[model samples]
Target: MVKPNRPQFTDVEGLAAMVGHGDAFGVGGHHFARLPVALLRAITRSGVKDLHYVSWAGGLPLELLLEVDAVAEIDLCFSSLDIFGLPPKFRAAAESGAIPVRDWTALAMIQALRAAQQNLSSMPFQLPQGSDMLARMPNAIAGPDPLAGTDTGFIPPLRLDTFVVHAQRADASGNVQIIGPRALDFAMAGAARKVLVTVEEIVPVGALRQDGRQSILTRNQVSAIALAPGGAYPASCLPFYVTDYQALSEAFAAKDTVLSDKLRLPSGGLSERLQEAAKVSAETVLAMPAPAQGDKKASVDEIIAARIAAELDNESFASAGAVSPLANVAYRLAKATHAPDMIIATMSCGHLDIAPSPMVLSLIESLDCETAAAHAGGDDTYSTYYQAGAVTHEIVGAAQVDRRGRVNTIALRKPSGGLLRLPGQGGMADVANMHRDYLLYIPRHSVQSLVDGVEIASSARGLLTPAERDPMGYRTGKALVFTDLCVFRLDQTSRELIVIETMPGVTHQQIRDATGFAVTFDAGCRELPMPSGDVLAALRNRVDPLGLRRLEFVSAKERGALIAEILAADRAMLERLIAAQKSPAAS
Candidate 1:
């Protein structure tokens, strides 16, 4: 019987030490586990074999743990070799009859944790418990209410043993304080065994009470307090400081290194003051004003110039009759995989041309969006619907990803001390939840995109900072993150993102230049294809084209190329774009 007052370890190792040798902790089985890698490492170091991970872990850790002959059973939600990597342990876990696969949600897990925290046998949940996942899950029963079957037929009554949390600040008595987004930490705290709290700064008791706002985590609910400065490092959100995308990108890029190289970052090295300062720096940069450099007159001139250049390029192309490299790539992939209905995108500010070609859009438009949307069900609200349900495949993009198949799409800092903060909860979180085979798409190298740490608060679910996700159940989806030059897939067995393929023209040096993280090559890697003409045509014609005139930062060559491509699809469309470019209303 699990109870809320039980003594749990605040140290990661202690948390791991609590699980039975063969006991399996059921993480959110549909997505990635929210625990930080360091904390997870302690659990793995505990040498338990029976692990019930969510769908999003990607199997990298499972594979590594298997190598030591420690793991014996496993469970999965959906299988995507890219996010989860290639690992034999996945098969072993499946064969062991220990696999308890099911469809679950962050809400259900939170309810379970809440129940554990409340020291109750079970807590009432109101989510769609009638879904297939809870059909036969132990302890989950149909509600007695007559209206229960009207929407979802059932309710989940989850049971858990422990809930671990890390916070920005805490007193020695375990008064935790958080500085970022809160999904359901309070509910999780209410559902787990003696909650373990880790804080960046352990303040005196009086400090918390002095400010009425310090009720982030009360001391009474916490069992032990651990002073682990920088403990959150790459996994926790330190308000004001964005994540270290550079460091994380390097780890993702350098796939040949030991998995631990990607997981272990020294957390105890940084002083409390420095950590706090770094956090502030991140916030300061994010708070900075967006540039107001766009001038209407200049924008019109640039657009006209670009349009003229494109005409020349098109004439040249007419003679050469050259095929677009990107178009050809898209065609082959569509042909080889059969026609997929939708395409997934990220940070997509209403523009498909950022990376997708016209031909790709055409192919997508040909499919049935209505049908695709229906099949996608609750997960279809994202812009990228291709990867949602059974629509063939879709493309996904991520900012920072670790070997554990974890992705960071939230706050990350730039080298110049700037931050790219989302004004709202962008579609990344929704995309992660809906997409089935997420194809990560990004440039080969990111100057400040990948980092050793993440600063921004998570806008969506998957593996949120320790403070945000407590009690170990919620998870997010991460399939393959494709960059300009290479593709990183999760090893199915270990659930680690490993280099599985490289782009046709990508070189190691070029990849390094294009990426913000380290990259490795797969000896047996295959070449990824680009967009086809049909797809490109659709992308060009169907998607609205916007011209950024007087955007001084715009590259002339890129502008010319884009203009030429846009004109080739339809001269009339180009005229509209030019008109828009000339309009002051564009401002």
Candidate 2:
């Protein structure tokens, strides 16, 4: 029934063949949405070795390839499983020095792809000067800008040999259409030598033209198209499905079976295996108990959120990036309480004037607000707004913060040659540099996190003095550090982190013992004002009634116990089914 004249129509094998060994492959998707998982699975099954990968927000595809030893090198902005937690295999590979990785912020990565697409050799960017990223990346160098007459950092173009993306629909002529934010897919497709697309459906030739705006890539840009429905699998494909978070969480919790048993099918195709996995996921979720409820008192996450919200002034325009659920809540709470006119931006290309109701775990799913406006253009447009000083405030988190308020979300390299890679600086570096002023939020406080000096400075005030920072386009430097135990601000003279206030019942000794360096305080250090009953009510009853904040603090041991309980329940059900089948009723 299909036409053979369509050059776009191809099998997964053909898709895999297009990407040769040692070629740079640009993968499309953000976190979990619209990933070309089926194609990646095919490549893994084909035993294709020594491929290099470039991604914006790396997740399942990257982790799977690492598991099977398919990747030789990777270039990424951030690599994490998002709400599902860290990717075990990717961490193991990076920490063990089995693969080489080059890190960039989300904006930098997107700009690099854009530069390649426009056929430029490199692109100038405003990055945090004197950050450790400058040292880690050889291609990223400071040079005199011909236009500005001042030195600025530049990132070299990342040319890809092949680019792969999954979409909602595509025509036989290879016109690809995406429903939600395209993220980096368009730029990546343009930057690559070959473009392969997998779509949920193959429609008539003119079907995609009906909505010209949604059609991101033309026939000339795309080389091959395959019908790979549910290509993203556990990840969501907007307009078709929400992310199967329950399934993905279970798969991540049961790490031992994810690669060998659930993902890789022995005989059937990738599509079939994915369907079976989905069924299993649904059943497992149904069998499990409901999430545990929290006590009547305010959770640590709510307290953190409220404190961050209290910092915002009226007319503030803020942006919160991925893995920042608490910050997202803070934005909403700010709008609802004090800053009624505050504008909040989400990574999913949405702008909300009104706070979202019953906050979801992921901001991408919080698209139902009455006054929300969608920015269909994606990250490029968002970055432009950030660069233009439209974003007045930003809430960013870090893996490490030094005495000078420098932040590091990259890796901690050990003398033993193993690297402990935290999720790389997503857009934190860019936000910290571009925004007028920003607050740094750290949920957990410890000696390792509040360090004497960060092992790697992913985002920082840098060595520039306050006088120099103004001319360099930095409006304010490291305004505040909000942590569980206390609030810190940088000292004006020494630029050292100084504790200004402590949470109720927290002692000076406790703060000192937790910090890696000697603690300093203001002359009038005071106890933080406790949240009023009304504020606590707003956070509990309105903001997050489901108590999703518990997910952030759930220990590994607790997760293991939950996983064990699920497995035990599943085994009991299977045994009961087997016993029923053996009974002699009909026979």
Cα RMSD (Å) per model?
19.3, 7.4
Q: What TM-score would every model get versus the actual structure?
A: 0.42, 0.84
Q: Model 1: per-residue lDDT, tens digit, 389-410?
A: 2222233334555544344443
Please report, in order, the local distance difference test score of every candidate based on alpha carbons.
0.38, 0.69
Query: Which 10 consecutive residues of model 1 have the lowest summed lDDT?
Result: 314-323
lDDT of 2 by residue, 214-312 (tens): 545777788888898777766766555545554666667674564623543224333332332222222232233333333466656777778888887
The best candidate by lDDT is 2
Clash number for candidate 1: 97
